[model samples]
Target: MTSGAITFGVKLPNLSPLASRDSILTTGTVAERLGFTAVWASDHVVFTPTTEHDHPDRRFPVGFDTPAVDPLVALAAVAGATERVELGTSVLVLANRNPVVVAKAWASLDLLAPGRVLAGIGTGWQENEFHALGAGDRFRRRGSATVEFIDILRTCWSDPSDGFTGEFCSFGPIHFAPRPAAGIPILLAGRSDRGLRRVASHGDGFHGTNLNPAAAGEAIARIEKYAAACGRATASRRYTTLCELDLRDRPVGPDEDHGGIHLVGTPEQVAERIRAFDAAGISHLALRVRALSGSTRKEISNRLSVRAGVEQLERFEAEVTPLIA
Candidate 1:
């Protein structure tokens, strides 16, 4: 366990009641004001029955009826609404789309936010959803497709004169312009050995989802091992993870480790979990809180208790942040 300062970011409320234009912008505005390092948005083009079955209840439990905004568009809106805070996609399914178009879209967003873009990308798992997208043929080899897609993005961003010709996409000498001054930081998200190898080979950092301290440490070890084998330095490679922080008192005996990676239980327990994560080498963490979640059918369907959410974030900063090692 290494003692290091862990930067905190908040996942923007971009689904259901929190997904409204106002709520999304409000959450970004508040997170920026609270001194959070970044604001992240999750991606999902179209939800299907497969989505519900694949994801755990805590993720897509609201079913297909839940409103989820497109990740890039949501970040663009947040881009115009706030400054200083980095804009990120927790794990955009890059392999499901044409790389040229996606690259252009990301470049446009980077122009708006300048250097504050963290591209957290992954090969999507929903096979049916992959079929829904036009790139169904490439689903089987999405790992390689994703790798080539990053190549395309970097190629176009750096120099588009030659363009790219990869297994999944072939483009002419496209005139791509308005590049991000700071360049997009590519963070790879995966839980497999192949994923860890990609982290060592391609990613500027690892985007860990639902990873606890022990698991996070093991993953980092694998990544370092791979990096050493390839003569790559892992020093600049950041360790970041996303998890839910159910920072409320309850009778459930602290289901912190039961669900994915979560910071549950009292404020003290939450603080301890964060310290453990920090000790495990997580340098940054983006969290989702329950206080800011959706209301029941009796209340407004398209609204979030933003005030409660803000209070919860404030409480974390005041109470938990100070307690971490």
Candidate 2:
């Protein structure tokens, strides 16, 4: 961990064709070598025509038409390729799969990476995805299902027998083995009220997106308030977030506000935003950088080639890492 700066991770283009074996291996190795604390793989099971998130920021994973790779499988390959960088799913939508099975997959990922897996998860927004996965019925109740889902994961990794009896799933006795030597950490992502409460109730951490210092602090306060109300211990809870990184040679004037969706500008300017996020209580910061700058907005792009994405990340390592470290 570098002092004076938050732990940093690069978001891999894992959801696209760029997640080819060669690309994953290269990206993971390069990020680890560049001193990144982790390399994250974003998840999606199937992309329908309705899959364009079209977030106002136009972030990566903008279109579902792109070739998609399974996040856990990609990261497992990355685990064999890199020695240290943490492998994360920058959220697997819990309602899209059976928790018992996905829990095993994540545990197996840990066997490969040891304590290096951050099982970043969330109750997904795309209700259609649940239908595609044949779990459509779980989407509406995904919130409560996810709470039980986390319970299932904990039992899978730490307990020998299954004894849960949730509305979505029920099991009496089963043998699950070769549990992870280091228990996997579940970091829940959400911005809604139910989402925040879910994190405070069951998550080892909170995973936020597109937030600035004030916004981050405000959310953390909410998580704390929720945790206190539930009598959940807050000391071990971690806070991490993903923000867009747009670095160009031109300087962003001091007056520009990116609305917290982006950390855009020259390396120096972006570094300042990074520092602010660090001060705002982000222990780990995941930057989703792209090869090109924007599909629609002045910033944000999902059209990333392996070569260009790697180059952009290398540039951040050379230019931004020093400013913060």
RMSD of 1: 3.8
lDDT of each: 0.79, 0.79
**What is the lDDT for 37 in model 1?**
88
Task: Name the regions of candidate 1 deviating beyond 4 angstroms.
Answer: 1-4, 53-61, 250-260, 293-304
TM-score for candidate 1: 0.90
Model 1 is weakest, by summed lDDT over 10 consecutive residues, at 294-303
TM-score against native, each model = 0.90, 0.92
Give me candidate 2's TM-score against the actual structure.
0.92
- Checking candidate 2 for backbone clashes, the offending pairs are none
> lDDT by residue for model 2 over 1-325, one digit each (tens)?
3537488887776765555777777878888988889988878787677556433344444455666678888898889988899999898887678888988899888888889999999888777778989989888888988888889889988884747787888888778876888798889999888889988989899998777888888888899899999999645888999876667889876554457556778888888888888877888888776552222244434566777777777888888878998
Tens digit of per-residue lDDT, candidate 1, span 179-284: 7777788999988999999989888899998788999999999998998888786457988998776566642363334643777776788888888888898899
